[model samples]
Each structure stands twice: as C-alpha cells, then as structure tokens.
Target: MVTERLSMRNMTKTYGTNTVVKNVNFSVLPGEVHALVGENGAGKSTLLNMLSGVTMATSGEIFVDGEKAVITKPTDARDYGIAMIHQELQNIPELTVFQNMFLGNPKTKGGVFVDKDREAKRAKEILFELDPDIDPWEKIKNLKVSQQQIVEIARALLANAKIIAMDEPTSSLTPQEFDRLAQLISDLAKKGVSVIYVSHKMDELFRVCDRATVMRDGQYIDCVNMKDMTEESIVTMMVGRKIEKVSHHSYVTDRVMLEVENLGRVGTVKPASFKVHAGEVLGISGLVGSGRTELFRLIFGLDKPGLAVAKHTRMSREIAGLDKPANGKVIVKGESIKLNDVHEAIRHGIGLVPEDRKLEGILKSRSININMGMPSMSKYTKGGFIKRGFLRKKSYEIMKGLNLRPLDVDRAIGTLSGGNQQKVIIGRWLASGTEIFLFDEPTRGIDVGAKSEIYDAIEELAKQGKAILVISSEMPEIIRISDRVMVMRDGEIVAQLEGEDINEATIGQYSIGQAKKQTEAVL
Candidate 1:
C-alpha cells in the first residue's frame, strides 16, 4: 500500500449538543492539490482547524507518512510540517514585509546576535518567488490586499512546511495575482508539497485541483477526481440537492432612476457617467485599483468629487442649487438634489452595502437585533420613547426572511460566520426601505449556497422595482447576475456590454483593456 503524505480517519468534532464535523475521512498524496468544498457551516473550516491544531478533534486517527501523529496545538502542527493560511490576513500592519515574514523565527549567527542581513536576503528570495515586484521593506499596511496575500504565502514557504492549507486565499486577489498564485501552486506540487485549497470559485477549483472532497451538514459526502466530476455534480454533493442557476431578464426602463454625469475626483476618479433604471442590475467589473469603489463612494456621498451630478427616483425634499450645477446635479423623480453626505443619500432612498463589511456594515459588539434596528430607528421611535418590542419584532422578521442561522437576535453578531454577518448587513438596509441598492463584493468570502441565496435576493429586489448596482472582482459573479456589465481598468470605464455579451470571455477582454473604445472613457 502506498503511504499518504497526510491522512485523517473518522475525524469528528462536537461542541455541546452540536457536531460541526462528523466522521470526516480525508487524505492527500504528495505533490497533489486537493480541494475542500462545501456550503457555509458544512464543516470544511472545522476539519481544517483540526488538522492545523487550531481545534482538537473529538475522535480521529491522523497519520503522516504512514506513522500515527498527535497535533495538540499550533506549535505541534508546525513541528509536524503542517501550515495554514487563514481566510483573513493575519499580520502586524506596522511591520515591514521582511520583518513580518521573519518576526517569530529570526536567523541567528553563532547562537548569539540576530542575522538581520541574512534574514532580509532570505525574505527577498521568498518574496521574489511569489511576486518579483513586491518591495521587501514596504510596510504591510501600505500593501494592497493582493500583495498581503502573497506575503502570507511566502511566510508559509519560509516555514518549510510539507503540507499547506489555504482558506479563501484568493478572495481579495486580482486576476493577475490569481494567475501568479495558480502558477505558484503548480510549482509547489512539483516540489512534492501537498496543498489543501478551499475556495468557492468553481472555475479556479477545476483549473488547479486534481481531486476534491465535498461535505454537507458536517458530514463527508464523496471525493471525486477532477477529470470525472463536473461543477454541477460537486455542487450537488455540497448542498444535497439541486440549485438552479440565477437568471435575470432585463428590467431596464426609459425612466432613469439614478444618473451621474461628470462625477470626477481630482486625482482619484475621472469624469464618470452612468444611469440605472428603476429595476435594472448594473454590474461594475474592474481590477484592484480601477476606481470602481471610488466611483461608488462619490455617488453615495462618502467622498466629495470635484465635479459631480446625480439623480435619484425618490427624495425627501427638493435639493437646493440645482440651477448652478456646481458639482453636478442629483435629480430624484423630476427634481434635482445634492447628495453631499451618506445621510442625505440614504434619505433620498439610496443605500450602500460597503465593501468592507466589518468596518462599515456592523458593530461586532452589538446584538444582532440592535445592528439590524440601528439603521432605521426612527420607525420604532414614538416621541421620546423607544419601542423595544416593535424593534425586536422587526429584527425577528428580518432574520427569518434572510434565513439567518441560530436565530438568536440577542447574540452578538461577531459570533456568527461570514455569510450570516453579510445577511445582517443586507437586512439592515432592507429594514430602511431603501429603493436603490449598491452592493460591493456582496458574495465575497461567502460560500456557494449562501452566494446563491444572495443572488436570488438581489434579483427579487430588482423585480420589486428597486434599482441595484453590483461591483465584483469575480468574472462568474459579474456574468451571472448582471443584466448589463461595465468594465473598468485603471480608473476608467473602457467597455460596456449587455445581453449575450456579458460572458467571461467578453468581460475578460474588456477588463484587460483589450476592447476598443468607441467614445471618451469615464471612471
């Protein structure tokens, strides 16, 4: 019998009355890239945690090179040649790239002084292997998310780990960075390093993985060779049933719901122009620094643009100074108004689901009920008294509608998973009765089943006459949900596509600046 590099048999983890991972049997051969996939709460993370010694398994037999092993803590896992890069970047932002890479394990000379020069040289070598352009002396805080991810990969390699497990590592990466990562994984496999890759991106999994293990409701389903399995079959094993692809018929109307003309920030964004109808989903696709988020910030009134003009379909009152057209004009219904701030924009029936959810969407310490109710408190207020009962009732309804698990409104939102936290943020906006929704990376860091649910929710809102805008880095996401797609590159909108033109190839062509422009570009 051939000995596996890493193997687990009947691995089970339970907390109180709940079993998060149930008798999961998995293994990986040397030089193989194995994918671990499942819906949210399907035990993928839990299984990985056990292998990495972040959490102990209740019952299991772990083997390394045909020998039984014990992994009781992180140090034990490291000693056993195991390493993990979590979904979130975990690094000291103030430290330089080289400093962060060698922070815990420093090179020493003669077992006395630290070998700073040797450490820096080694760090540079590892960094160059991942991305030759990255500066080793640059601070982690200054690096983009994609750059930081590469740094994490370098750190794992510096540890000389035989097995590395990566969780959603490409969630924040650009197309170029992802390509580099794919090549890196291929090279690592050639070096006899086993990789356990976890990602919700189907295209990426099929491209890189040789085999995949699917889990559902905390139990192992089946492991299939990539050559023999299709995306549909893998998804079926994950969800235990079939989920139809989300399709949207164009709901565009001649009546403009939101319009921006000449909205430009001096050094940041250029003169951007676009219009959304009462029920259309306008998808914005771009590279990392393409100013898609910046344009959205200007429209949402989070950033002051040097030149701006915006219009909405609903407003509380007619905005002043529409005749001057100083920063552009925002017209709702038939009256022009100025959305100079977020409150003003919200008051005019516009809502923004910010890209950084934890920073801008929810308060981690607050209860789910409070987080959901805080945005629309006026509805539950009477004179000087706050209606706690009404607020609780509304929060409950929102939870039920969004299918939030555990259903405990009193629990802190921080205790929930990534997908559940997103639902709370979306539910908060729904409670406010906003007519126009702007979602930034709505399915980012979320699982496949949850992604489907969010897609359905977005389409349902469009069907109900609510205009929606989506900014996504994933090409599949842009093609699946967008009725019309606008591709941005280097702070400018280079191409716009609609109908059958919104496939991966067309989006890729435009995103990489290959599409010829017919008119002046806008960012």
Candidate 2:
C-alpha cells in the first residue's frame, strides 16, 4: 500500500482583497513524483510558497507523514524536511559551490570556530549525488544556469529533505540538462523522497511524473494519474475548456515586411536566412540548447552576424555574388538603415518580447507609468530630462489602450500580475511607434484569462499590419496567432508553413526538430 508523505487539507491563501489560493487539497505519496502545472498566477506557486513557509497560509493544516505539522517560517519548513528550488535562483555569487551548498548549517570546531574543510567535504559528497560533473571549488557565480540549479538541488539534498519541490527548475536548462533532471527525480523517488515538480512545460511533466495535480484561478481543479491522460487533455482540464483547433486565415500578401539575408553567428547560429511579410508571424521553435535565441539576438543587433567581413561566402550567386549580406539592407520601407541596437529594432517598427521575462522584461522598481514610458519617451522627455507629469498622463493612455486593470500609474511594476507586467512591456514598445513586434513567449507565466487577452492583443496588432514574430513553447499559441509559420531547428529555418498548411502537429514536428522526413503533415 502506498503511504502519503505530505498532505494539505483546505489550504487557502489570500492577499488583501485577492484570493490567490482557495481551499486547495493535495497529497504526495512517498516515492512519487507529483506534478503541479498551470498558467502563471493560477495559484500553483502560491500553494508551494505556503507549504514551504515562505508565506503563511491564510487557513490550512498540513500533515507530514500522517502527523500534523506547523510551519510558520522557512526554518520550520527546513526542519520538517521540506525544500524548494525557486524559479529564480538565489545563491551568493561570491561563495564557492561547496560553501553555498552548506550555507546555513555550517560545521563548527569545538562548537565555536567554523570548520570549513569538513563542510566542504560534505558539500562535495552532496554535489556528487546531484551532479558529479560540478566542481565543489567552483564559485557559484561561475556556474551555468543549469549548474546553478544543480547546486540548489544539492543544497536541498544536503538538508536530507524528505520532500523536495522544484519550481520550473528547467526554465533555463538545456534539453540534455532537463533529461538529467528527469533521471535525478526518478533517483530521488527511488530513495523514498517525495518530489513535487512544478512546471509549465507539458512535455517534461508527461515524460517524468507519476501523477499530476492541477490548479486554476487559485483553486484545486483535479488530480489524476499521468498514464490516464494526454497533454491536450491535461491542458483542457487546467483551462476549464477545450482549446479550439488553431486556424490560419489565408489572406497573406507577398509584401515582405522584414527579411534576413544570410544571417550568421558562427557556431551559435549558422549563416541562416528567412523572410517575414506583413501579417505573417514566423515562429522560431527548437529544443533547449538549440540556437533559436542566437538567431534573433544577431538580427536585433544584440550581437553581429559577422557579415561585415569581406571574405565569408554568403547568399546565392544570384544576389551579386556578395561574400555576405553586408551593405544589403534589412530594408523597412525601402530605406537602407542600420539598427543602432535592440531599441533601434523597435524604433524602426520592431519590438521583441523576450523569452525570459523575469530576467529581460520586468522592471521591478519602476511604476507602470515609468515602465511603459521607457521605450517611447520622446513625448515625456526633452533634452535628456523626463517630464514626470507628462509621462504619468501618457501612462494612463497606454493603459486604457491595453485595457489594464486598476489603472494605477503610481503602483510599483512588480506588484502587478505576470500578465499585466507583460502588457506593460508591450505597451512601452507600441508607444515607441514600432510597426513590427517580436514577441518571445508572450504568455509564459500568465494565467488563462490573461492568455485570452494577450491573444486578442496579438490579433489586434496583426490587423494593424504590425509584422509580429512570436517564438513560443506553447504549440496552440504558435498555431493560433501566426498567419504563416516558420519553425527553427538548430538555429536554421527548417520549415515554413503557410495558409492551408499550418496545423499543430506539423508546427510541433518542426518545433522539436522533426518537421521534414518523419512528416505527420496536415493542413
């Protein structure tokens, strides 16, 4: 008989007037990988935070190994053998991997002076279990994102945690690293440690979990064995409805809005090329570690495509036998121009909604007014000085356009929900007068209601002839908005589907780098 390791009864959480988590009941059995998945702000993280004692539950009782437990603080959680790895990593950059792993529980000599050598040895042993490739002496700052995650996991295991929860642990990890994590979860489960895996990625959950618990708008929706469901079915349950099949509207025009000729970033992104016309959204998709990001990074001038050199052979012989696409225009409106940088990409009608919003998108300290005013500040600033009054008024205008709630210009940007924060970023660029928008995972951490709003925003942009480039992990999203789709694999445009050709299965195939020969081609 399977025994429950952890259980939460009538778990509820509220923030002032907002009820984020509501009467949620959940359980994790010993040696089970129980997955919790939902759109961002659906209360998944809130419940985890409550269980980990990072935040107090408004009303609830927790049972550990059938014994009622009290966790008022993080230390209480630690003592109860409950550990969590947050989406955003928190490690002292200056500390060594060994030191960070044994942070709070330091060894003491004669119960007074610290014993560094002994702690380092124990830390090393823990790292060996989590990831043998990581060096104990390496500085925490020097580790890759994935390695840093491993260090966090090692730190959790060091506590001898019976229940370890990973919150989007693979968000920054490579595909190989994610596979490694799957195995590590399996290994942890085998050792009788109940693991709670929280992620938005369907593929990862489907591959690894034994059972999945879903939440929606801060309420427990359902719990079911992984074997009894498909990804589509799981998503349907989480969202509370069937997601209609994505249809591509066929009135595509050949007037190319953007064209990349022989774009290259050697080793990172090969000399790749593609074109996107007005009303068409080219979707660049790939497994983690593939250079989908690099290809766009160069195009947006964050990095050069190395085409300025006079020697490299680039483009076909027909376009004047040029060694590269240098001196050739990325031509918007037949105007030969240079993108000063990413900002210039927007100035000339391009806005990129980056994949990792927490890192590249959100500005926590500023208010909604300041955030939206940033990209397009000409109306609010004069001779390098900003006019606060003007900017505040303009912020309201942008908010009204996006139909943002609360309409509070004075509130700090971080206080808003994930979807609202995303809208603020988009609002900034729209104010910048950008005709083309590059949206990378526009709905990543947002909830279902917010997702519908964002999709409407995308369609609205397209109707205004705003050429949008959307790179998304969500297949339904890629299929829903893109008038025509182009899939990227290993940093190259592997497949281009248009009009009657765009469908979930085909785009999905191209997304995972299998669009061509093993074709499940459908319209």
Whose lDDT is greatest here?
A: 1
The alpha-carbon RMSD values of the candidates against the true structure, listed in the order shown, are 5.4, 5.1
Quote model 1's TM-score: 0.91
Local distance difference test values of all predictions, in order: 0.83, 0.77
lDDT value, residue 428 of candidate 2: 82
Q: Give me the candidate number with maximum TM-score.
A: 1
Candidate 1, after superposition: displacement of residue 128 in Å?
4.1
lDDT of 2 by residue, 152-177 (tens): 88888889899999888876665667
TM-score of each: 0.91, 0.81
For model 2, name the residue pairs that clash. 349-435, 349-436, 351-438
Per-residue lDDT for 55-96 in model 1, tens only?
999999899888888998888888888989998888899988
